[model samples]
Target: MTIIETAKMNGVDPLAYLADVLDRNHDHNISRLDELLPWIGHPLP
Candidate 1:
């Protein structure tokens, strides 16, 4: 199921649920790279 559907089934706000998931599992290296790519003018492959 899609994220919004899963969130509704679990009775949580979708955006909040997504944020929580990201907070719990996201890698800071990837996050920093994601933010930096645009500033570096290099598209990620």
Candidate 2:
């Protein structure tokens, strides 16, 4: 719920946000996790 709400607050599609984050998370650097936040506007690869 928090993820959905935060995405909405940032004007991002919640489903897209979650899907992208989950897909990237497997290979993303944990130390730079903030880059995955909805507000960061990380483009889907």
Candidate 3:
């Protein structure tokens, strides 16, 4: 499924999800990467 569809299925607003991921990607910890997945349904720590 497409990112928009996946994000929605996971209860995230598509645009906001993309924006947060893009914004946090550079500095986010690689070990905790799973936390960034759409299914997590929470903001970055």
Candidate 4:
């Protein structure tokens, strides 16, 4: 019933599962930005 148990039962990679969960709830949508920025780049002011 726990997250690890469920993920394991479904044969999902733990890291990938965590990433997908985080990505689903990501606050920013940089993909829509006009300019592609490096992952460490600060947002325009």
User: Residue 22 lDDT in model 2?
Assistant: 92
User: Model 1 Cα RMSD, Å?
Assistant: 11.5
* Candidate 4 or 2, higher lDDT: 2
TM-score of each predicted structure versus truth: 0.48, 0.91, 0.80, 0.46
Off by over 4 Å in 1: 27-45
Global Cα lDDT for candidate 1:
0.50
For model 1, residues 1-45, the per-residue Cα lDDT tens digits are 476785567556666655655664455575454433222332222
Please write out the lDDT profile of model 4 over residues 1-45, one tens digit for every residue.
Answer: 475566666566555665655554456566754222223222321
Order of candidates by lDDT, top first? 2, 3, 1, 4
Lowest summed-lDDT stretch of 10 residues in model 4? 36-45
Compare the candidates by TM-score and give the number of the best one.
2
Clashes of 4: 0
Relative to the unseen true structure, what is the C-alpha lDDT of residue 29 in candidate 2, on a scale of 0 to 100?
A: 87
Q: What is the lDDT of residue 10 in candidate 2?
A: 97
- For residues 1-45, write the lDDT of model 2, one tens digit per residue: 999999999999999999899988899988999999999989954
CA lDDT of every candidate? 0.50, 0.91, 0.86, 0.47
Clashes of each: 0, 0, 0, 0
Clashing pairs in 4: none
Off by over 4 Å in 3: none
Better of 2 and 4 by TM-score: 2
RMSD of each: 11.5, 1.2, 2.5, 11.3
- Highest lDDT scorer: 2
